[model samples]
Target: MKESNYSSSMTGLELAREYYFQVGRPMLEAQFPEYLPKIAAGLVGDGSECLGFDDEISRDHDFGPSFCLWLTKDDYDAVGEEMQHAYASLPGEFLGFPARNTSARGDGRVGVLEIRQFYGRYIGAEQPPKSLKRWLYLPEDKLAAVTAGAVFEDSLGEFSRIRAALAEYYPEDVRIKKIAARAAGMAQSGQYNYGRCMCRGDTVAASLALNEFVRQAMSMLYLLNRRYAPYYKWMFRGLRDLPILPEVPPLLLRLVRENPLRAENAWKAEKIRNPYLNQADERVELIERICVGVIEELKRQSLTSRNDDFLEAHTYELMERIRDPELHMCHVLEG
Candidate 1:
């Protein structure tokens, strides 16, 4: 039998764009010229493909030759099903890739969609959110997904406009609030509980505290860079791109991956002196060091005034820098 070559080497975003320019756009322009100016075409949603993180391994399921076609409400009502059927009838294979399985409208990531509905599915709002609660309630990952993917073309202009506005980053007050909240979390986990847990010989709990500290610290870095943190799986990958603290990710990985407890074990196994009395003492040292870096960045950004490594003190100090009286008045953990 002739060997079948099935390994897809193209990224999902590239595949979608190829499908759009080669087939989708031409089809729309030739068959429905009137709707061409009113429609938007692109690949976007909750998948790794939307973030350009999709690789060959991502092609096992929803990964395929597909793109979203968004239309104004009136245009959708007029020919939505027809457009959907036409899009569905597109070549089942393109560039050696298979077609995506169709799902009911509003359920699947790609297909004919109303402009408002498409945005709503991701961010819980049909339009760019203007209120603090709306932005605060929407998860950063969702916002990242909404703004990450490539939009092939948006002749209607509505989708791209909303996207542009949202890409501007959080408002000043919102950013301050989020920074305050994450700083508070980092302080609690790294400065306060990590040592106590270690002293109690609760290695597991100490590790958990380290995890929480890293999580909040990473979020704070993204806020400092004025970018939304991507999904948890890509957190470290995303961290390397931060302009303010690109060196932090590797240090963080080391702190988490190298267990001081393991070091103590190796010492006990050899029947030699335990160089460190507390197995977790090294971990605590690393935690404090990370806190020190955060504090330096806070000072550099003029977000805090404290010189010490007490993150909770810095947290309050940073909150005091927010000029918005209402935001300053909100609880430190509000975000």
Candidate 2:
């Protein structure tokens, strides 16, 4: 039998979370049972931990014994201090792990935090949204981030509503705004800009055009799916995980990463003067197809209405559905 090594470089976010799940939760249940029903504990968002991208290298002063606790303002104020004290009292060491102070960044992990503060930092507000204004205010990645990681304990069920509010997805104008933005960018870079850049012998600029095309295409897809695009750096890595366009993600990546000079040759073969130019146009078509595929996936999952104008006005309708406060939450689409 082989002995497995502990993932030493694991995320402080996850470590703080697992600590609570194994040690903190049980300890709290035994000593402070009353608080259990009023709050929730879990992990989600872009913190290296949430995405499972954290490592031993991630353990800096900022890393500490951290987990999220959710409570309404009243409940939070009522028991906040007591809960904080109790949390502090929990054995400082667990499974050979040491707890870190939450204030500023310390040598250890950033300890527990309230859900409101956690979400607010990412999106500038706390609690799930029930209005268009709140919905519109949410940054795309933050919504996706909060919903990305796992929930270890959700006693109060507050996280679900936040997740649910975002679950319905992006709003109508939001989609158009992002799509129009990305489309205009796509037209500028792939449709119009890349060609001109290549013609000028600015291969560097040509490459930038490819990058822009890839970005706009991705924003277009995420908008269509009513999901937020993750951080720009991780967009492609994350985009590959989307089931709707798995087949073409690699292809898109290939086009984006292709040599600008050689790509120019392919475009001449395409008789389009711009190798990357034709590639960009193809992306526009691909974006529409991917959009339609996602809409069909929604239908398959029963996530949308049949009479909702899917074919004629798919993106807008999806955005509209997501915008409706009454319909903020949605179940994951079934295969």
Model 1: ten consecutive residues of lowest lDDT: 271-280
lDDT per residue (tens digit) for residues 1-335 in model 1: 11126434567788789889999989998888899988888987777788777765554567677899988889999999999989888896787776674444425688899988888877875468867766766789888988888889887799899889889988887887898898889889887887666656677887788889989988988998999888988877778768897767777888878766764454434442333234335565677778788888888888887778777887777777777777778889888
Per-candidate TM equals 0.89, 0.67
Q: What's the C-alpha lDDT at position 237 in model 2?
A: 65
Clashing residue pairs in candidate 1 are none
Candidate 2 ranges with C-alpha deviation above 4 Å: 1-17, 53-65, 85-110, 126-137, 261-335
Task: Judging by lDDT against the true structure, name the best candidate.
Answer: 1
Task: State model 2's lDDT.
Answer: 0.58
TM-score of 2: 0.67
- Superposed by TM-score, candidate 2 places the C-alpha of residue 323 at a distance from the truth, in angstroms, of 12
